[model samples]
Target: MAFTLLSRSPRLVICALLCIFLFSEVGVPRRASALGINYGQVGNNLPSPPHVVQLLTSLRIGKVRIYDVNPQVLSAFAGTGIELIVTVPDDLVPGMAASASQALQWVTAGVRPYFPATRVTGIAVGNEVFTGDDEQLKASLVPAMRNLHAALAQLGMDTYVRVSTANSLAVLATSYPPSQGVFTQDAAPYMAQLLRFLADTSTPFWINAYPYFAYKDDPTKVSLDYALSNPYHVGAVDPYTHLQYTSMLYAQVDAVTFAAARLGYGNVPVHVSETGWPSKGDANEAGATVENARQYNRNLLMRQVSGEGTPLRPKLRLEVYLFALFNEDMKPGPTSERNYGLYQPDMSMVYNVGLNQLSTTSAASLSLATSPATRTDVRKDFGSLCLVTSLAILLITQALLL
Candidate 1:
């Protein structure tokens, strides 16, 4: 009877086999790395929010960190699955810290309306407050965080949105040897209080760790290759911990980790809020070329996708957000300041940092396929295939039994 059915339904059997093969062979949408880019809108000629959304989606970028809560940006990203990290500007910190009602009102106006639609995961209270010269603003950091967090809790958004501030690398007094890292005496008291709050609330300590600035300040001592994570350089070894560091970025991160540990907040996570290389600079700026920028960002992206962690925190993957999405023409600083953007204000890439080709069916995908990191989509696809295959086999067996 089974033979008779097979003879009559040969096309059906062939079609079923073809379907299984096609499903198995199709390239699944592999999960990209946990990398996020800073969507800095300091320029006057940046693309509109909708265009920006399309650009990010095209690049398969799932995470972004904006300097402020722009309603247009928030509305544009609604239902897009991209996780957004919004900020409370530094100027508003003092006022928000002084009044809980103000904090509540600010959240209601800026954040509460477009939440689930926008996917606002984290709220950065201020950018580099500890490094700034304003003493009053420095004092307002913790209070601002507390008031904002309280406001979030009152609105039932605390569980969904985390509160933290981004601090500069200048907050550290000594960052050599990684293990001996310590916060500067002036910033220590405030850092300790901030760390306690971060620990209690389980918020990450955001640091703008730029090795480029360190290299630029003292080019004679710092190896360019080390700063760029070049494989040719024999990187430094932490004398105390005997840990090897191939890149200055990881060393800086470990330093912050050690600094936090010293303050009895060992478990608090440290995230790189901003880090990038400049594509162009003045004659005095060493290693700020397009080649260096490409190498630095590409290598950084590869490491991020590989889920590589610092030597100090080998098990936990490092979270990093690259600085400046566009070259801000109005930014007042050294030439390097405006050149750190990955793209121009026109949305064209400054250089091919391997990110623009990430979603393409080119050699980049082949490179990604061989990467050490686990692709979430591949795992999910295989699981789905296995279920489908099992069902198909069961149906075939039942047909044969009949």
Candidate 2:
């Protein structure tokens, strides 16, 4: 009823429309049919999950992965058809491994309530544990995965959803020429066990492969064109397999594929859990620029659209979740760490990678009452941006009426 009256008041209506525009986005579909994007919320400013879903739907982007099982996000995505891959924070790994009940409890609380509607396709056990210095954490990885899988099986959600953990490319000790790829001595035994679990579970081996790191560390040696997936660069020859690699991203992925094959689990699918270039960086952090970011993402999108696969596994179309959806301002480390988003917190594109714009759509209002706070991720965000704007519009309309 208020919407009716507000629509009749030109000035008040203008304010409402402007505020909504400030909080929402509708995008044109990139040619990519199955591109996945990572949604990180480490900033004090980000659109709420509902707004984000509307934005992604407009762009026709389908898959998404979040660092944690945020209840707000899980609830908002209900019936949205967005396949979400939620993570179990690293700190919870030991508890999950120590007790099967703990894992079950996690699933009961984090997953069960929203699953069928949320389309939670997978649960990432813990990210990059092998690359960390914690030996206990590395040892606990498999048990945690097993217990979680058992919990899923117990609940009959096993077949409905997959179980796996994302790993750092650093887990590889040797990754040159593709064929020489091997897991580090420290990570080898664990990787062996992990790969076996994946093979059994029929899940994927998730790797966060970033060729930008290799180039940033040694730009002169790593061709800029190759690193950015530019098609014109003379492809490098992986002498052992002789599979030519025109893109460093593909080479890194193939390296992981080879590493897994060496471990006798070649049938296990290798997916890129996280990969993207930063739009800005500090002076010491080389190769982090807006232009580079645009090129990297644009090229990657083209590959996804064309259904291109790595030379090692040419038929299996790569399923990649780009590193981030927004530039998280509060993330620690170098400036580059905070600048990986395709859009700013307010949802403005950092640089267009051919993601066109279309007509507007309504984003459902967010209900923060159910969004529980977590000790692990205590950072604040502007998820309330739309709500605040809506209130402003209401107040404006009320004043005009008075």
Candidate 3:
């Protein structure tokens, strides 16, 4: 009897495997690249980080970038398997550069405990330090980065977590031709040395480029379609590189590429640290309408999934992180600056950009809120609710079967 049962079990397992394969093949959309979202919480009313994890998982976004090493965010991401890139805020640079001990202490307290569970893949030493007003901060940028890298190396986490900084396009001198790009005279030496360090370490050079700003600055001169990634019209070409570019954003990227090439670090990889359009803007902030924001982000996401690269680097897949997950009302900027979020503070998408849905009306949207669960909060309210509902339905079906 035991041998006969074993003979039938193999057939049963085969049938189950076939069913699982067929179901999955028919169900999932064939997205090409891994999707990553930025989870910035500059607002006070955002949801808890754990709940944000639930929302991101439901949306199938596998990676996230946070603006700071908030212990709460780091702790919440533990065991979640979401790859995170955390920041070392600009203000921390002075202190970190002053003391290797401080850098070590900060890393030990802020990063060490969450290892293996949190999957912190990258550390941004500072955001747009080159663009900041303080000359000391600018000088401190690379040193702070070096100190942090040393600290990570001491902890044996250097290979797993890369160290780098994000630069604003203000670092560039001429971005118009996209091929004739160069750093401001004062910044050239510092930037070149930083680029060398980045290249040596195999860390990606991060830049924040926004064509929206270009268009807003000179709408009459900038083609709307060109800025929005609309291929309605034939675009310009770089005479030097002979690269035919379609969008201002790509041109901006290639300009940086050429600039790095000029500085002899052409091989260094560049990543878009931030880019997005705002749904609302001050009246003078041209091209900041809701429709334009939707189109810009939708098209950007489409391009990202298509695995498209700039004309200069045709084979490399572009790694991009959209800016501001929530429209942080408190952020000091033109109205548009505060409104670039993909979602609102209340956990709803500012607009849909082709997320999957079983029912036509369902929203598989992104949210910026953190999770409410404490470290000890084991019973996830959302997960438990879903489980209880499933169990109740199962009990009902079993009673009917009886």
Compose the digit string of candidate 3's lDDT tens values, residues 203-321. Answer: 77989988899899999998888898765558788765556878778888877865664565555668888888889999899999888888887777767656577776655556777
What TM-score do all the candidates reach, one by one? 0.81, 0.80, 0.79
Residue 31 Cα positional deviation in candidate 3, in Å, after optimal superposition: 15
Q: Mind sharing the TM-score for model 3?
A: 0.79
Candidate 3 or 2, higher TM-score: 2
Number of clashing residue pairs, candidate 2: 0
Best by lDDT: 1
lDDT of 2 at 324: 88
lDDT of each: 0.78, 0.77, 0.72
lDDT of 2 by residue, 142-162 (tens): 999999999999998886678
Off by over 4 Å in 3: 1-33, 357-402
Top candidate (TM-score): 1
User: Which is the better candidate, 1 or 3, if ranked by lDDT?
Assistant: 1
Name the Cα RMSD for model 1.
17.6
Q: What's the lDDT for residue 246 in model 3?
A: 82
Which is better, 1 or 2, measured by TM-score?
1
